[model samples]
Target chain A: MAEEVENFEPKIVAFLCNWCSYAGADLAGIGRYQYPPNVRVIRVPCSGRVDPLYILKALQNGADGVLVSGCHPGDCHYIEGNYYARRKFAVLKNLLEALGLEEGRVQFSWVSAAEGERFSQVIREVTESVKKLGPARRMVKSFEIPKEIEKEIAEA
Target chain B: MDIQSEIQKIAARLLKNKEVAMVIGYGAGSAPNRTAPVFIDKEKDVGKLVFNRFCVNNLSLYLPRLKEKGKIAIVAKPCDVRTIVCLIQEKQIERDKVHIISFACPGLLEKDGKTLFASCAECAVTLPPVYDTLSGEAKEMERNEPFTDRVADFFSKMPAERWEMFKAEMEKCIRCYACRNACPMCYCEECFVERSLPRWIGEGSEVTDTMIFHIVRAIHTAGRCGECGACARACPMDVNLAPLAKQIREDMLNLFHHQAGVDPNAPAALETFKPDDYNDFIK
Candidate 1:
């Protein structure tokens, strides 16, 4: 809510679905893959399990970039869940780009349980993208709204 | 091609399922000209099922409140389908807990013979393309106005007039939270307006309070509203609030490339922040 101090480490929230992306991340860890340490993962059952509101809430609550990874097509633990995510992300990607948000802020990719290396590569890429864009506090336009409403919004 | 018979048939089958506690879909109202969301739990109620343009409510919004033990099957239009997808994505409801019956959805009928909503008319695609059951004529996608063009035309009006329009529309609000309660996305255990700790909104509500409620509600809806018209339909006062909600939904699409209820994997605009997110309006 104030001036950007030096040495600020951007906090990225990565929502990884348990069936695929989570296992992929664990694979990255087990293999000792090196990537930026910014992302904090919230694991769910499927990528389709990640709610768009939760992504918005994370951003509003001061997260910088959110990466959602799920099983590749046809591999979802729940059949066709990722397909629904694909349709949703297509629109979401368009909306994010239109808002003038940096293209890399909300990244989506298919990472199966075995794609450990691909998961690491994605995290590295997302980190690089977020790094070039810099700190994202300006992403929200709600600063000037009244205090009462601000309190309510913060509560939201 | 009459969908009423099909709906009744589905309702009958749903009621017969011991696991299905209810089947929430459109039903004929007391009047010929109106349609409403009907929760059918008993076999006798299957006769109430109806399908018509006046059946504009997105019955899926009633999903989150239902007890999880019983399966609930819902009839969804393409637009309503997105809401169902969004709900499942958010973990507000489990995907396996409910069933979906859908239509390729020729879009909403205005009860005046119109085939689509103003937003639906401009929409570029049909989604969640698969369904548990299908109904109506499978409509082919067609080109129409762009969402932004309609928005620009709407906003080109005088500012004071626009404010007057909003104020007039909002004056009809009754603090029923019918709109909130009718929304599938508004599944918070304790909604912000209901909290007293910081008292987000004073409970001794009035026109001003009501206005604040709607305005903030619209803002909160920013990218998440699906334009189901559930708010206006549920409103006892008929505030005709869909226009405002639709605007933000379009803006979210036009500006942020985000559509509420469409995708499970994609992050919402404010949810997953980018370091360089557009904040031109922030002071």
Candidate 2:
């Protein structure tokens, strides 16, 4: 018989757009959905409000996984906000992948307020995937230069 | 059409001077979208010099490396002309040794590519406001705000967020160094990044290594940048860093009231120190 493996709890960061995704997550909570408790939600007004830098920062700050959930396509309350985010994230994803980030480290999906079940399912899935991946090594911010050395650039 | 005959005539006149060795200008490529820098040696080749919407290279980056046989003539667009003005002001080159046949610029076209230069989108092409000889369309008026409001919006980003944006951009860098090579003001004999004794950048493309290269290059161009937007155009990753350039331009102009490559006599912002140079904001 194969050895029974222990289920791991992943540390996930969800950037939810305030208009729809956040409301969906809230509905999931009110409905007593058995979603994973690993996620720390940051409520932003629009998906465009979630800049790619914010994702990088979360990863640097030790997020095992990042889930950027927004309103469904053409559904952003702030007309065309998601369109900009779509362009930027597409670029950001390629850069991260080029930097050796695995496919599952960062994921984007759309979850509307009408789909509380989908939001619950996504959180649970992201948690499981990240648990398998262990942690994000590429996102660590290891570039801090010493102050005196930096200050003496002209003199040096 | 506006500049072809005029440039040919000027190149002929410049070649007559014994001290002048060459005339650097644009040549017709295979099509309308193409233009290349032509170094004119023979007077007959002067007819080859032409200017149009496609004449885009800043070309000043070449001047510092050339072991000039004698005085050279350059086809001066307003931006390249601005670069020359700064170089002359810095005594990097002798102004009299070169003849500048400045041409009125309508604007420049993007190199035939999927990725278009964003700077061309923001270009006013007017406040290259002065030149020695100009040809092409009727000159336009200088812009008052020009290229600042965008930088101001980016400035409103939280410092942490701003740093992250920069990180994301630098992360995409393949260490091509195209941005540095394309910059007209980056004409150091031995650039700080390449110094063996104290290499400012590591010799590899580790994220941190590339971050140093970009941060230093951007800072170095601080007040010297003429906002030509050449650096961002040369980037393969589409990491448009023009906001940093725009910010530096605005800050220098605001505090020092100095515009780079514009005035023949203006000193570099860092060089001529003033006891009363604004210190109120500095802690």
Lowest lDDT sum, 10 consecutive residues, model 1 chain B, at B274-283
Clashing residue pairs found in predicted model 2: B102-B133, B104-B135
Second chain TM-score, each model: 0.80, 0.85
Correct interface contacts retained, every candidate = 0.00, 0.00
- Give candidate 2's chain B TM-score: 0.85
lDDT of 1 by residue, B1-44 (tens): 57778877876877786557788888777776578778888988
The list of candidate 2 runs beyond 4 A from truth reads: A1-156, B17-19, B30-32, B112-117, B121-130, B141-156
Residue B132 of model 2, lDDT score: 55
* Model 2 lDDT tens row, B1-283: 5578888887887787654788888888787677788888788778787776677677766665653667777777777777887877777777877677775555555655333345655655553554555555555633332232334455567644665666677778888888888887888778766777644446777675665465456556655777777777678896758666665565567656767777777776644434344433111
Q: Report the lDDT of model 1 for residue A60.
A: 52
